[model samples]
Target: MSYRFVTPIPKRAATGSVAAVYSASARELGALFAPHLSPAPDLHAALWAVLRESMLAGTAPRARKEAVAAAVAVVNRCPFCVDAHAAMLHATGSHDTADAITRGEAPDPLVAWARSTRSAAPDPWPFPAAHVPEYVGTALANHFINRMVDALRPGSLLPGGVLRAPSRRAAGLALARTVRRTITPGESLALLEPGAGPAPAWAGDGPVATAWPAFERAARAGGALLGPTARAAVLEAVAGWRGEHPELGGWPGSVLGAVPEDERPGARLALLAALAPYRLTESAVAAWRSSVGPRGDAELVRVLGFGAFTAVSRLADRVAVVA
Candidate 1:
């Protein structure tokens, strides 16, 4: 199969029904990133749960939130996300505004704020102080997921006009519905306590604020599985990276070279898989899968997801601090 996946997709039988809902939505959207997550349902659920709270379960109007999401998608160059978010805007009778955002135009101050953060610019908090939490949190959350999905999806993604027709827009709205219903705001925190991690003060005191703990839990889970040496190497390899730019950032020359040669490729791939998947290659995927065997594949998924969560959320921390 040419390594259709480096890790097993979250199967209904393996991950149970709750994870299956995420699987179904991912399949429906052709979301390349979701298959990689099936191996770690809790992490996957945690990611989406945070996004749902930050973007949806807040005081911001639904259309405005979708517009904010569309703007973030435009900056991340994720057409699939642009479509999904734009359609949500359309469903809320803001199709014109959605159209503008998909083209990279900042329709308003809030959308502009999201774009500024993408370029590592200051988060001026153009919107109300109360809205900053969800807005910026959504920015940070989508930035993480967009990187993973864009890295895995085909170069030329879905066309923009598919939803131009009224009926097609309705279809997109339906897709968004499936994604919304997958997990509750705090469903991922069912077994864990909120407010466990000491996050930055800029974290909005909204539904999404608790995401810090979920992300912390995911990082700890992967850290436990990977051991200290691998964890340190991954962090060192990605030092100084902000996880904003799509390209590799200050990639240290082969951080895993100290390990066994056979293990080096897997270790390095794991680092990029976590920090910058846009640089992932089929050869690398093939090598890592072949070397790791099946068990290593699942472990790698946890490592990458956790790694991305940390890197992406770190950007959020910085934004919160600066703002």
Candidate 2:
């Protein structure tokens, strides 16, 4: 079964940080997942580092973080991420919570807060102040990843899209042992450059604080693929957003009118990725690919990843660590 919109590096060909992250991720997810992001090794490493530190390696219960990941994926309308995370949530023995969440019910305050993180005013951080980094960081990471999955590969992480409960439970069972393993914090930080960027104040002092900024730095590097006009257009649009779902009509197109004709495709694609990734379509990708000529898939992944993280950062900035 194929997994990406573009060609992926054969696992054997992965080297350096990419190889290391893939090996680490496979221990939990059971395969060399995220092949599309592998083409840009730094971005892949940074993303995995953030995800590992925040989701898989924190003092906060991994179940709560998995709930956050699943909620965030639901907000983005990413079925693929929802399935993956919900299964992990189940693996953590929160079967009732997992079932409630998959049914679109918020089973607890943490789950409710996770669902609200994309709003202009998210519910007061539901956990202790100390947990802000882990909880919020997990949400931000999924916010970034859900968009990448939506734009690049919009389907089940499971084989043949078999999302039945039996399959989901089987997956949960496969991951149960690894889900309970203790991962040391900050181990993934070795993959990041020192002082790549400042951690968010809301993150407090923790490995998540360190990892989130580094991932942002690596992901934002993709914005360089856009021309000045196109890049500015994406930033401006994202800045003005207020957590509302875009009106899938003429909205993004209306905003891109002032951008240069040649730059619209990239700008449009970026805007959709940041604000309404569910609206992204094949034609939208085709337009960007055609305008940019024969650039490789890594460039495209970078641009979309940049747009995704831009929104993730914007929303994450608004999250307050209420005691």
Global CA lDDT of candidate 1, please?
Answer: 0.60
Report the alpha-carbon TM-score of model 1 versus the true structure. Answer: 0.75
Score residue 88 of candidate 1 by CA lDDT: 68
Q: If candidate 2 were superposed on the true structure by all CA atoms, what would the RMSD be?
A: 2.0
Superposed on all Cα atoms, model 1 deviates from the true structure by an RMSD in Å of 4.7
lDDT string for model 1 (1-323, tens) is: 01335444534455552354455345433243355555666666566656666765667676676777778777766765676677767766677787788677987877887776655455577777787767777787787676656545523234445534454367556656544443335543453345567655655554566765675576457655454566677666555565454345445334565666555555665566555566767776677566656655456666556566656655665667554
* Candidate 2 local lDDT, 1-323, one digit each (tens): 36445677777888888888888888855566577788788888888887888788878898889988998888777888888887887788888887788778888898898888888888887788777778877888888888887777777766543345556677888889988888888888888888877777866788877777778888898898888899998998888888888995798988888899999888887888898877788788888899989988788788888888889878876775444
Task: Name the 10 consecutive residues with the lowest summed lDDT in model 1.
Answer: 1-10
Question: Candidate 2 has which clashing residue pairs, if any?
Answer: none
Minimal lDDT window, size 10, model 2: 157-166
Clashes of each: 1, 0
Please provide TM-scores, in order, for all candidate models, with all chains considered together: 0.75, 0.93
